[model samples]
Target: MKLLFLLKEGFAGFRRARLAVTIALATITLSLALLGLFGLVAQNLSDSFQRVFYQIRLEVFVDPSLSESDFQTLKSEIERIEAVQSAEYISPGAALQEFEKDFGKDLVAVLESNPLPPSFRVLLKTGHSRPEAIQAVVRRIEALKAVDEVVYPENLIRLLDKYFLLGILIAVGLGTAIFAISTLLIFNTIRLAIHSRQRVIEIMRLVGATDAFIKAPFIFEGILQGLIGGLLAAGLLWLAGDLVRYLFLPGLSVPWLYLAGLVAVGVLLGCIGSYLSVGKYLNA
Candidate 1:
């Protein structure tokens, strides 16, 4: 009987503060939609970066003086490294041929001899692809007597690492700001709703109503508000994403996880906002 009354009051709170609830729901919808859009952008950019990372390979230039048998042995030794996925030997002739294809000119005609060293084009395991991991691999290769040089885009890797971290920090800062704003908006609205029932709440408290009992209805109302706002926000974000994607990029993929998460965020925020408001009355 008490549970039923709390449930009834929970749903009734929305009716009691219909205007405030409507405004709060709209605010939550806009906030969550923006957050969802940001999440989608972040996810796609991360995917694109991983694709580029997969293309990065370590080029190990070997000492040209080594015998063909010794070179083959060296290649085999490199292949044994744990980080090395595969090491393909690029013979001097093969390198020259590849160069000529790119330049469309015979290098032999321009130079007295083929100066390109025999090298190994090594693909690394995915685990060893980070800027720090690749550095260890470079040190390992450089330690070898057969290797003259280990050529890779060290600067590019460092730049990417720096910028990637910066991007995450910026995103987190922005997301937090948006979250705080949304939280406060809902909190204020819930506070106002509860304020309207101060007399009833005081009477309930005097009649031996536990704090939990008094708080339940407000919590339920806030959660309901959040749920509706979340659904609206998720739908708005999806529609905006779909429309903009079709116009700007023909193949913009929708991440369902992000969309679902946005709705969850909305519900969570609503619950939190309600609790925050009720705490004021209970001094909790």
Candidate 2:
């Protein structure tokens, strides 16, 4: 009965201070939405890159003029390496055929012969995705007498490493800033709400109400406010996902679990902020 009465009073207080509550909720929702969007995008980019890199094999171009014995020896040596998943010899004719498949024309018609060189296409295990590892492999392959040239996007690997580092730094900085801002906003809102009912709190204390009884309503108010704000933010995030799917990232899908986690975090922040702010006043 006492709890119900306290809840009713809390509802009345929330009604009386609807404008401030609405503003605070709106701020929280927007901040959470931005944070969620950035996190999802970063995660999706990482997953996409990993998937592409894992399936990609290093193209090791073998020397065209090497003797048959040297070619056999080179293939045998390359296959012995643990990092080398599978190394296969692609003949000049095969390379030309592949080119024709892509270009839809016989380059031989213009050049009189397949000017393309026979090569060893090497596939590496997932562990060898790093530029250093790829460089080491390229050096070993180039050292072989049969290998004329080796080429893989060495610069691209370095660029990816730099980009990944930058992305992590930016994400951490933005998340911290948004979290601090949201915490401050919620704290101030709770403080203002308490300030408005200072007289009522005093009356309750005078009437022999315990600190728990006095603080319960404020705690509930915070939880209710947070739940509403979180739901709104989640709804907006879903809408944004739909818009992105329609306009930009139709093929690159961000996981639903990530969006769900964002809403859960939003709710927790709201409840915790309200509890901390009200607890301070209750102690006072």
**TM-scores for all candidates?**
0.67, 0.73
- TM-score (C-alpha, index-matched) for candidate 2: 0.73
lDDT scores in order: 0.81, 0.76
- Model 2 gets an lDDT of 0.76
Most accurate candidate by TM-score: 2
Error of 2 at 171 (Å): 2.9
- Candidate 2 steric clashes: 1
Residues 1-284, model 2: lDDT tens digits: 99889789767767877876777678767777777777777677768777656544667777788888877888889877778988888889999999999989989999998899888888888868877787888888788776778877667677776686687788789778867776677667667766777777788888998988888887788777767777787788788888988998886665677767777776677667767776776677
lDDT of 1: 0.81
Against the true structure, whose lDDT is highest?
1
CA deviation > 4 Å runs, candidate 2? 2-13, 48-56, 61-80, 84-127, 142-151, 162-167
